[model samples]
Target: MKRSEFIGEFDLDAVLTELSVDLDIRVTRRMLAGACIGSNPEDAYLSARELRESLEWIHEGENEGKVKLTTILSTACDDFQRCLYYCVAGKGVVTMLDDLVWLEKLLEARGRIAGHIYRNKLPVKPLVNPYVAAEPDGPLGRFDPSFAIGASWSHDPGPDYDSDDRGPGPKLKG
Candidate 1:
């Protein structure tokens, strides 16, 4: 099929089917928002709108055999990496090195969560970011803000750096 024709059929459902292992509307939305590109503002807006509608459809329990959000996201990350590999191998457009770094971090975080879940077998509650507040009447109605946000996890001597002390050199810029 022609690229234009293929793209035309690549709707949200198609994307979800491609990326989803187990998915939910709200979580699916949150994932997409994190993955949204800012290079084209209009495209971002349209993408969000489309994603919202698509997720709503799933939220209403329209899609059959849907899986868990984490699984879906894990599969998505894998699929994204595969696509990147294909792009490079096929001499197609490749994502920026910074984007690759970010993706690598995402993959690592996902792997950690998957490993933790596999080891624990406990219910892993989704920590909805305060910035992207979940609707009270939405699918994820019960808000679970148990996780920390914007906190530095590094051991760097923050704000206490002494010029003469030479503390592990300058810390990497976030």
Candidate 2:
């Protein structure tokens, strides 16, 4: 599946709820909001730190059939990275570098979670069009023409067309 399709199909809140149920980890929107919009730098740092530690704990446990947990942690890591962007936007780059360092640690933790999933051979359902065959080299190999909007057809000039800088005109059939 295309990356855009995968992103559009994945539901972060649903995955978070599934992870919370499977791993018994309480991940709340409030915690995420605190990480994203803390009152001060220290508070933001603390929130990110706590979230990262929680991810580490989750990674250490057996997550055989918890593919949703992996997705949740990956989403959390992306949220933390976005928070760093906000930090850089508000504060100078020099100060935000410290946060960048912390973000790297969080990324590493996320990688470990991914590694656990890969190692356990977890079943990740692919988001695909049921009408299309599931073969990689089949009809799905080509981009769906329906996705093309406002595509210019000027490049395709039919035979017997005069090219005197007029370009291709719309063709009509009787």
Over the stretch 91-143, how does candidate 1's per-residue lDDT look in tens digits?
A: 11111222233334434444455456547554443332222321222232222
Clashing pairs in 1: 22-67, 22-68, 23-67
lDDT of each: 0.30, 0.34
TM-score of each: 0.23, 0.25
lDDT of 2 by residue, 28-63 (tens): 221233333212233344545543443333334433
Give the winner by lDDT. Answer: 2
- Clashes (candidate 2): 0
- Give the Å error, residue 98, model 2: 0.6
Positional deviation of residue 8's Cα in model 1 after best superposition, in angstroms: 36
**Model 2 — which ten-residue stretch has the worst lDDT?**
145-154
